[model samples]
Target chain A: MKILDIYARLKRDMNYIEKELEKSIYSDYTIMRETSAHLLKAGGKRIRPVFVLLAGQFGNYQLDQIKHVAVPMELIHMASLVHDDVIDDADTRRGQLTVKSKWDNRIAMYTGDYIFAKALGVVTQLPNPWIHQIMSKAIMEMSIGEMEQIRFFFHTGQTIRNYLLRIKRKTALLIAISCQLGAIAANAPKSVSQKLFLFGYNVGMAFQIRDDVLDLCGTEQQIGKPPGSDIKQGNITLPMLLALQEESLREPLLQEIARIQAVDGQTDVSAFIRMIRGSNGIVKAEAMAARYIEKAIVALKDLPDLQAKKDLIRIAHFVGNRSY
Target chain B: MKILDIYARLKRDMNYIEKELEKSIYSDYTIMRETSAHLLKAGGKRIRPVFVLLAGQFGNYQLDQIKHVAVPMELIHMASLVHDDVIDDADTRRGQLTVKSKWDNRIAMYTGDYIFAKALGVVTQLPNPWIHQIMSKAIMEMSIGEMEQIRFFFHTGQTIRNYLLRIKRKTALLIAISCQLGAIAANAPKSVSQKLFLFGYNVGMAFQIRDDVLDLCGTEQQIGKPPGSDIKQGNITLPMLLALQEESLREPLLQEIARIQAVDGQTDVSAFIRMIRGSNGIVKAEAMAARYIEKAIVALKDLPDLQAKKDLIRIAHFVGNRSY
Candidate 1:
């Protein structure tokens, strides 16, 4: 199944989730409402919510029942993006101006806080402390992931383990929770929910690796920002990490990084991008992402085969193959 | 019934709370643990926790039962302060370097987020969904309050009602919840809990009003920073609001504000301070704070009179009279 086919199957539910996301972000304050709407309108793939709805389909598929989990999951993602933009000091995301660029960092911070509060406010209505426990842990991990990212910025000593762990907390955990919670909310069997979690976790890991690769390889139009922004911002992702392993490239890369960090202006990133692209780093990262996709598919094999399960397989492959 | 006497009575419980607070902030990550410990060491009066304990006394007070609520309340307060410093671009708070100043805004934002997550993580361990409900609502109100404050900055058209509402969310709502949640956690009577909430609400209002007044009249030694920092940062407090009512002072104050807003330097605030101090604004603001304290005392009149109740009355009066 193609990504389009899976999306087609989930279109009605996705529309409902979209509306619920919009409804959940309503604030009495105008700037908050506008800031939140601005980010929401920028549009994401809704991958987390999509995973949530798909996982819920394994048992007791009810859009209304799972939306409380789904909408907030997406809203949490949106809230993080707003704050992430503030941290990145990026002017645009997905080709639109960020909240920080449009207004200011203070406005962006408050908007993020407000959206997070609304997410919490809506989630607590579930009447289940277990769900709260899961979400609180996800949020905690996500915050830790952000801290790790900030501390690791421009640091040369980072390893593959560091990269995996950071992305695990920043991306994989939330996606895993989105799937697991949806299954749990639908009263799916415990084993099934656990399997869904692993499946989503592996898929999420692959998803982020792919995103990091695209950050280097994809163009401005494709990735929605300038190519090589991660390196420009001193974010050492998988592609850069792989490139650093080459003995010939290491010294030059280190020199380039030092020069880039020393200056405030736009230092040319094209030379580094050209060097990395010429190396086998992209191939190695892609292979690793493919391995994660395989693991994700393997995890879902134990669950009873259904259309949703098929779509989960398709999503894993799509994540592995997605260009941007 | 002095502040020191109240501290004497609550000292044992406060120590336990202090330990629990330290334990709750422990993280596997070094920066998180260090950043959080830095803020925790730069202690406030632990007023919110004290309120929680004092209000818990009205019911079947168990230190273990209420300590969970009390510690997280303080942690949430700490998290907000960290983020607030980033927003204010403040170099120091409470006589110590702020988290932002110590590290950077990125670290400060992450530390605040990590602390907030820890607070939420601790709170979710409580099984009662109602407690989650109350805490969630308080968090929502606090977030909205922060947004209102951001929007209201440098806003000349704000009213007394706007000022009151802003402080209600920023300060009083959390205090009120600290009291109300304490009563609820101890399984207090509903009417008693309601009364405690009102008492806390009024006390918090008066507390913030007095704090705003002190911001104008206090010396650098008293406020732990220079006087008029609020107006310096575009925060128009109660005294300034009242001073704006005087027809003659209004134009000069507006001109000073515009000038302060324009150039970024150490503008002499002494002239405006002298003018406001010479006016009736301080006296009027004090009267308003006194009324709130009176209402706070009145809220508890029908409850079973006990030492805790009397201590609460003393706290309200202390808040009304506190110079810092």
Candidate 2:
């Protein structure tokens, strides 16, 4: 019955996961060791690991077994991000120059590979098919999602269902797997694991939606990124699509969209931002996020009485309501 | 004392491996499957799987188990080539238009991912620690080699040792792992497997050196690539480094190097090819390939009396002496 704030607990767990990840990549190549260290130091929210740890608590929860799953899941996340920055041709990540922008695209790609190798190597230590099954499957889905995103970029007619499925593959599904893996590793009952998985899935969907909303509403300092960035990158997020629907605003929107698209895919972005803000896009997005929160909570209602489950529910609520 | 010509046997085995690879990727993504199949079909000697199958025969061999290792290893090789084409921005491969060239970079990247997924999925079926360990580490090395290659592009003063090391990771190590994994999967004694590893390692090193020679000496029709293409790509291959040592040849070499660099960084390349062909670079490179063939034979002296081992040695000699 230890009632600890989720972020604080996440901070504690991430410290160890961070340490283990750093230790794992130590090799004779001093340069590779140093480069990998720089990437780890770049830092991330460690949301995936947090999902894993929390989900483990829903079962018999052995920390030793859970670490194996947690580390690899996070590394996979890290590996994907390095490649992502390259594909996005991004300059800065977390207020620092990305591995790609700093060294080059190739180093970024290898750094990703090094991390993936280290992660997969760790999975071998776990004597089970369950973990490999979940992890490899997750990687496959994430890759397919990325490919679809790349293929469908700037295609305005893509349905919300398609968008949802893509995001599910790209973002939410991994988070869901993290929880499922943690629960299974701890030998948690199948029903408990399924419920935890349901909870993770619903929260993940809402989490990505909130991220899109932040890209529209949150300031550069607020979200650690410039607002309307996705639109600028020609990735039509939910709010931008909603704004696109108002045909009455078509001329001005079209002008702005054309201007953005005209910059050879490097539009100023703020014009669309201003438009989205003025429109009720933000409000509509938040309402949608609220609906997801309700769904996530309902998934948890049948779970065993535990403070950890309550904390998870609280985090989901906060994710929906968090301001810039 | 089985006097079967190893090269002819290898050619037959390679063809079998290629057909199996095509069958493995036959899925619903017809475009992707065909794109991958075309790359596999547009031939290169399937040296890797040949090494794996040959190595497997050293122990308790099973076609079923060995095929899992051999087919996936070849698929991974094919996948890397597909991605390498995009990363290298090369237009043609194996005398055919590259996927990136015929389609686009995004499709090419996805095709690589799809093939990579299929590769891992196939390898995981073996359910052995040794296979995963070898395959995953080989993949990591391949990625690191790629990173190094990208980083060093157009930087001409790198030591011969560094170039060799880079090529080892990029080429030799994967082939070495192919042999080692083959031996391990067949339940060969550790000592036998280690010898097979060394045998493959030396041959792979010589194999790459021969390729560098061919890149300088062979014509497009004979080698499936234009002569001096490596120089055209700003790659300081062994032959280029050897050619640069003569101070008298240095300026013209430097000028050709500069022209190649220009073509690589962005310019027309036909003129650069013209510059390199008009030089003494090719002959010196062939002598170095000859030296490596001798070194590769030295690695096999301790192995047991087996027909597979003898044929492997003969193939290495053939590869070393072959000319376009």
Q: All models, DockQ values? A: 0.65, 0.48
Tens-digit lDDT string for candidate 2 (A193-312): 787777778888888888999888887787776677677777776776677677876568767877777785665677678888887667776787788878888988998778678778
Task: Please give, for residues A141-260, the per-residue lDDT of candidate 1 as tens digits.
Answer: 898898888778788889999999999999999999998999988889989999999998998899999999998899889999988888888788888889889999999988887877
Candidate lDDT (C-alpha), each: 0.87, 0.75
Which candidate should be chosen as best, given lDDT against the real structure? 1
Error of 2 at B112 (Å): 2.8
Residue pairs with backbone atoms closer than 3 Å in model 2 (clashes):
none
Model 2 TM-score relative to the real fold? 0.90
Evaluated on chain B only, what is the TM-score of candidate 1? 0.97
Clashes of each: 0, 0
lDDT (Cα, tens digit) per residue for candidate 1, span B209-228:
88888888998888898888
